[model samples]
Target: DIAHQNKREIYNLLMRASADAVIRIAADPKHLGARVGVTSVLHTWGSAMTHHPHVHMIVPGGGLSEDGTKWIACRKNFFLSVRVLSRLYRRLILDGLSRLHKAGKLRFFGDHAKLADLAVFDAFLQPLRKIDWVVYAKEPFAGPKAVLAYLSRYTHRVAISNSRLIRVDDRGVTFRVKDYRITGPGRHTTMTLKTDEFIRRFLIHVLPKGQHRIRHYGFFGNGNRTANIARIRELLGAETPVPGLAHDNTIEDADAPARVLALPCPCCGGRLIIVDTFAPAQHPRAPPASARAAA
Candidate 1:
């Protein structure tokens, strides 16, 4: 609710704090002692189109030395400590929220109106400071192909997809949703909401104007990203990466073309064959406004 009310401030704070947490922790000699780069993408909606704001980050396992002379690599099969990251992230976000409240940048409404008062707002944030905020770091991707595959899922996803829309009528807008609590096939279910409510939920994810959903930090930052990447590649002796690292089997290869019936039919377990193709029909135009009003 707070995030929806103050989308820009809250999301900006999340990005800043998350990036700061990783950079600070990794910079410490006890951890990795290097300046790592981070690419973060902000997502505001969950599977059911609920307002669940989160950031996904992709960080390389190593970084350049402080003096810019050598590369510092992390221990095998280990990155930074989750506990350390969680603690630091919690502090940074809470501190940032406090600053926002003090600067009168935050808003409160309806039942939460009392939070406008300093005491009330501090009380609200007290429990958050005590409890650990989760900052889960999954195992590193297997290779560049795995990294590309993982990033493809979230980098450009929307609140909902057309394929999930089951129906739309006077009853409501029925759509498919996944219940994360369920363990198996039973997790998939359908949900229906009034058209007005559906629009309201969808609009919650539309970011404030000019607010970028994806941002890069450190070496991947905009100003000198290309040069920084080239330097890093030179240092790692990977200036020329292997063809397999860049290969994606999902795309057709021009040199070695695939068979016409290489792909299987979606509905049947048979090879798909190309048939005849035709131009698409144009959609009918809507009646004039005068006619619509008269009707």
Candidate 2:
């Protein structure tokens, strides 16, 4: 409910706190003690289309020294402490929320009517400080292909994908969802929700107009990214990339036919089958055999 009323403010708070915490912790002598940069993307929906807002950041394994003389790499196979990040993130966000309330930028409605009072709001944030905010860091990508695959799956994903939708009938809307609490074969499951409830949950993630979901900070910031990357390459004595040529994992053949990613089906968890292919703006001659049989 709070997120619904203050979507823009809440998202902005998330971005600011995440970037700030990473930069601050990395600069500490106990940590990396260098100036680092990160690219952050905001995702507002969980697998079930719930309003679970969080930022996904991609940080280089190392950073430039404070004096900008050389690059400083983190210890192999590890990064900064997640505990330090969680605590600092909590403080920064709570502080931002207080400022918003004091500035009258935040709105309270429904059962939260009492939050308009300063004392009530302060009490509301009290419990949050004690609880550990989740700050996870996954293992580094295996290679460029893995990095590209991760970005392709998540960066622009919506609240839900049509491929996950199984059926819509008198039973309401049915879709596949991952139950993270469970493990092994029983983890994947299907859920059915009333039509109105499904729509309501989906709508909860729509952002306010003009809000940017992706952001970059520090050395990779928009104003100076090119210059910084060039300088870093020079310092490392690496060969410069060819001008106007973007690096990618695919074979460098412009005439080769494009192929779709082999993603598995959500319903049966089976590998994708290529029945047919079509060009841009052109429709397939007919439905696939399986879809035709299903219909």
Cα RMSD for candidates in order: 7.8, 5.6
Query: Where does candidate 2 clash, by residue pair?
Result: none
Compared with the true structure, what per-residue lDDT tens digits does model 1 show for residues 1-295? 7787899999999999999999999999999999889999999998889999999999999988887677899988788999999999999999999999999999989988899999999999999998868898988899886886677677878899899999999988999999988989899999999999999999999999999988999878899787777788889888555543423233355776642225534433244565544457956555557966857
Compare the candidates by TM-score and give the number of the best one.
2
Q: Report the lDDT tens digits of candidate 2 across residue range 220-271.
A: 9999899888888988897798754445422345675753345554433344
> lDDT of model 1 at residue 119?
94
Task: Score every model by TM-score.
Answer: 0.81, 0.83
So what's the TM-score on candidate 1?
0.81
lDDT of each: 0.86, 0.86
